[model samples]
Target chain A: MASGRPIQLFRNMTAKIAAIPMILTALVIFVGGTAWTVVYSFTNSKLLPRANFVGLDQYERLWNTNRWIVSIENLLIYGICMLVLSFIIGFVLAALMDQKIRFENTFRTIILYPFALSFIVTGLIWQWLLNPDFGVQNVVRGLGWVSFEFDPLNNSSIVIYGVLIAGLWQGTGLVMVLMLAGLRGIDQEIWKAARVDGIPMWKTYLYIVVPMLRPVFITSIVIIASGIVRVYDLVVAQTAGGPGISSEVPAKYVYDYMFQGQNLGQGFAASTMMLLAVAIVIIPWAYLEFGSRNRG
Target chain B: MANPATISTAVAGADTLPLDGPQGPRPRPRLSRRNIFIYGTMLVVAVYYLLPLYVMIVTSLKGMPEIRLGNIFSPPMEITFEPWVKAWAEACTGLNCDGLSRGFWNSVKITVPSVFLSIAVASVNGYALSNWKFKGADIFFTILIFGAFIPYQVMLYPIVIILREIGLYGSLGGLVIVHVIFGMPIVTLLFRNYFASLPEELFKAARVDGAGFWQIYFQIMLPMSLPIFVVAMIIQVTGIWNDFLFGVVYTKPDTYPMTVQLNNIVNSVQGVKEYNVNMAATILTGLVPLVIYFVSGKLFVRGIAAGAVKG
Candidate 1:
């Protein structure tokens, strides 16, 4: 193939021509764009990007900013809680649905329907539901618990949790569906053997079945992790980083600085941090899945 | 144990049953403890999942007078379509008092072209990768899929520059390009896998018949891949329609998509906080995806599953 003439490029020219858009998007947009953002992060470009170098200055400001710190804190709380709760709820729902119960389709349709709605819709609905004035607090108070205080949206400290509730409501359905598929893929003989051995169903699940769904779990984690990093719209629709920016997230921070604040340097730096967060989540998963496959 | 009389009758009638077996399948008592436990748990979960939609519908149907007096979960005493009409025609987002209609039409203009263009490009690209097997096609494909994992923020500004440089910035056409670029990876992967799964014999036969790459793709591949095309359409339509980030970033206030506009309408601060109108707007924004989800039930699951497993 290397010894071919200069006309070798024209050999499968139609194929290459058909592939120009994919090639450009893969190389120019994805690779080129990411590199551009990282490079611009080092500069002091305010409204427009420039080559004026100011290494570490933007990063310093980003770290020193109170909103950035709060954003990180909110992301940590939301990310950790989302990861833990969604997994538990998803796996439990999947396991329950695995039982030979009736109306399986109806239950699944109901649970998974939420996944269809956009995060914006989910956030707004949840914002309404969590509204202190006439929402859950009012309902509970109307039910005779007049001292109920469930208004996370307006409360600065717990506003992130309000966002988390909506996030979980929208996303757990997908996780449940993924886990259910994984459960269905398990060999029935394993369950039969466990039943014959008198092992409890939960034990059979925890001790035996879960380990087999490692790939599914890993996939969900990567999906959810990347999703956690890109959680801008949900926050925007729900809180708009309100109650004094207590619910700020990195993605929103980037958007505000770049577009809203017109501070391109800060936006670039903040988005670079987001890129780093995604790399942290994706790198190891990529290595585990692809690296070992190459070696084997 | 719950039905002693039925058990006694079955036992009494045992002699009349086949000697080989009692029956093909055993019938469990519906009111058994285990059945009750499972059904009760599922019922509670289903209600929890369905609560938001239920609340949205009930709230949208009621007047503000009733909403002020009642809890959000209560059914409307007198249902009115006034809120829906208001949400569609009278709600304000920023300076636009024309409601979600502008956003809705903007989204239609954005989504229709985007879905069609992205699918067309991706399907052809997938065909080339699967059948033609150029020297470095797989390398580019790998990078494309990896690009999907990189946060869109990383690429957002650079693409802004790119679009601006190309004289398409802040235009509907530019937003369409952005959608196509972002949707490329998953759509391409979907098509690649689907095309690769097709029998190679057909391609080989076409090649032997003197069909070139475009000829074989057009004649053999396109007709056979309709279902995958529908799956891709489903994925893209919902995805591009529900897109708030790209629409907000790329387009001006006048051309915001439904999701972005819906967010603005509900969260805009100056308003007197019309809860009924807000709920109505949200449901209206969500209605497209919801309709597609229910209409394409199993296909929707398959689309998401394909997307999920692409990792």
Candidate 2:
């Protein structure tokens, strides 16, 4: 086991060489780049990232900006609605699929196919479907229900909900798949014992199955939460943050400021907030997961 | 084996519980109430999920005049392939009227190298981490895993600066590098876990035969790791193909990948909206990933599971 110092330095040299890219990406890009952005957020960088320090001014302006406020509001509404609805819908679909039903693969394929498509495609498809003139409203009116109204895209008050519809259509399949896996992992004996004890299926699921699938639920939430924060392309494709910027999200706000609006300071500040939002979701989850494992 | 023991125990546990219903097999109907509820709910949800794809195909096949007068739900009276051709050849994004073909090829150019390079780099890194445990490797690996959760926006500009300084900004090469950088966390995790799960005896045996790092990787590990390589490919192909943000941020107009180009084409405001052409373009942009998904089948789910369930 005793080796010379020079030999130790040269040992596994191929590995160290191969890992250079990972090292650089982890150290320089992920760690260093994040630090650079957080630092630049404090400066009044316009069009270009400069060393000019203006402490907290960018964040103050970011808060005061109506567009940023709207983006944050839309993100919250979209995030909460997406989280709750996706879990409910995903769990329900998964449970139904688990009912020893026929054509389970076919139903699953139909539901999960949308997850294969990009957000852009999902957005465009929904935008056309929600077009008031030729879409759902027109069809209903032609069917003799002339007073029906179902347009959400053009209405500023409900545009974010419109985006939410497309978001759910594209994403809930992933949640369903994850939940289905979790359900399958449960022991069949649990269900049989419940049935023998005169417990209804619903009660058994509520009491026994769901709590056992807690890890899967947490994983689904983490995946969905990160996705909800990065809700950019769908907005850009469907509404283009339209109806007077009412559907703008934080990701879109950052993009417009950095690339289009030429306000790097604001972009950095907004994105820094995005990073913070992800941390708030991730840090505790990571601790509970990895922390408990190490201790046990 | 353990299976029979567990099964017998489970059967005994079920028998110990008090049964309220008849013990023997009761009269069971094919269309029972529970069956009706489950199948009916599943059918309704399936229709809702299928509606958009159905509408896309129907709308893409219709003429503009038909699209204007007809309901989106109604079948097209006249099927026309004109929209498909127009979407592929004549759809414009800014001054370039050459359509989605340009963007499609650009995506290919971007995807192929990005997938190969990232897999090569990550597979080796994973092998090294799992087998050749050097000093500080776990720390870097931990940082890499944590990096996946950091929002990409936080690193966007500094990457731009880095790319600019390295003279790869606004080029396809630059976008490929970006994909590799972001893809590192998940793919490395995939490979690392996979290699770790492989029997340690094989690796140690090769080492006893005086096999070095690269030699053991190429001679022993590579042959055994084909399925995981496919999983990584599936992840990268769909991911790089579906990407919009990186493509938009990293490349110029001529070099913009399909997603960005498709967005510009569909959302452009200069002319009257061509719904048929726009739908066709949308489908075109999505076709690559969709095909990969259908073809891969269960592997697609495995890819998502691998990417999602991080420890």
Candidate 3:
């Protein structure tokens, strides 16, 4: 045993050495990429990167720009609307299905199928359905309701809600799945107890089941929130941030400035701001979740 | 045997008591007007959830003339397979006027290799972290989890730059590499969490039998991980197949994924809006992932639920 110690130690060292490359690659890609972006934010880059440092001018311009401000505000509205709407709709659907409804799998599939499609396709379908001249609105008008005026796509003020509808359709399926999983995990004895106590179904769901599913709810919220921050494809595919950029979100704004507007510095600055914002929100939540898990 | 007889006697007594039994219903019928009202409301809600898909199907079948007539719910006046055929054969995506059919091979090419490599690397990493217990394993896992939360949009610019420097900016290989990198976090987290959940006694037994790390991982752990492995493959396959941004950014025109073709075809500003063709193309682009989702729905849900509940 004493003689074997040296050989075992050598084997352990060799294993550690083997893992070094994997660890280093992950660190380099994440750390190196983050550093590169932060540095480029300060440079006078355009289309392609040029190495001239430009101090804080890009930051200054980003803050003062009206489009940037609007985009930020729009993202806040879009994010909140999408999150709240998807959550409520998903929860209700999951609850209904959990009631042992007929065609449970079929209904679940119909709801989840939208999630399988790319946002690009869903956005296009939505755009078509909402178009003023050739969509549902015109059809409604053709039914002799001359007073109907459903044209959110053309209305700069309310168009983001139109986009939010499409987003909700795609996202609610994921929320439903998460909630359904949570619901299925609940003990049947709890339901029996609740029923014996003369508790109604809705009241039981609201008080007992939903509270039990809090962790799942939080997980769903985090996933949906991530999608909100990265909501570019839908905007591009549907509105192209049109009707005078009323529906513009920060990601689209950054893409435009980076590629189309030829202002990489400003774009990178905006990206930095986005990163900072996400970190601010996520870091604390992650700490709570991960920290609590580890400590226990 | 005595306990069983006593339980049966108790059940017989409860059944004979009927209304006085512990499982007896309320004095009056509980489900009244309010219950019917609630069920009615739920049914309407279900209809609302299903309406858009109904419209998409109806519209896809309608020709331009019927579509222009603007009856979303009505059956098509002249239902035809023309649009589906046109979308597959003749739709104009760009300077290349051919349909989205051209991108089918490209998507398969990118998705197959990317899925295999990502899953393989993730399995290796998961094995190392779970079994090896190196000094920095916790820190490495923490960073990887954090990486999962960072929006892919924020990483795009930097990734593009890195790819360009490495001479992979506009190649199909580059896109595959990017997919693997982005796919790593979730895949690694999944397998690592799964492997951690497994019986440590098995590993101890394997070690006592003179098994090395690779031997245990390959012969013991990996075989036990088939269910989670299927789930991981489904997620990666669907994600990579339906990817739009990476496909658009990293791939040359010759290698555009079906999504990019669908996007260009449906999103052209100056071209006439061909709703039929666009719908057909959308359906086509969505076909593979949809099929996967349907077939693997149960496994996918189980896998995600297990991972989420444990983590």
* Top candidate, metric lDDT: 2
Model 3 clash pairs are none
lDDT of 1 by residue, A210-271 (tens): 99999999998888888998999899999999988999999999999999899999999999
Per-residue lDDT of model 2, residues A47-96, tens digit only: 99999999999999999999999999999999999999999999999999
lDDT by residue (tens digit), candidate 2, B1-311: 15456765676677888767555434469898888888889889999999999999999999999998889988899899999999999999999999999999999999999999999999999988998878899999999999998989999999999999999999999999999999999999999999999999998899899988888999899999999999999999999999999999999999999999999999998999999999999999999999999999889999998888763
lDDT of 2: 0.93
Candidate 2 docking class: medium
Candidate 1 local lDDT, residue B299: 90
Sorted by lDDT, highest first, which candidate order results?
2, 1, 3
Candidate 2 interface RMSD, angstroms, 1 decimal: 0.9
**Any runs in candidate 1 off by more than 4 Å, and if so which?**
A1-3, B1-27
Q: Rate the local accuracy (lDDT) of all candidates.
A: 0.92, 0.93, 0.80
| Between candidates 2 and 3, the TM-score winner | 2
Stronger candidate by lDDT (1 vs 2)? 2
**CA displacement after TM-score superposition, residue A35 of candidate 2 (Å):** 0.5
What does DockQ come to for candidate 3? 0.50
DockQ of each two-chain model: 0.84, 0.78, 0.50
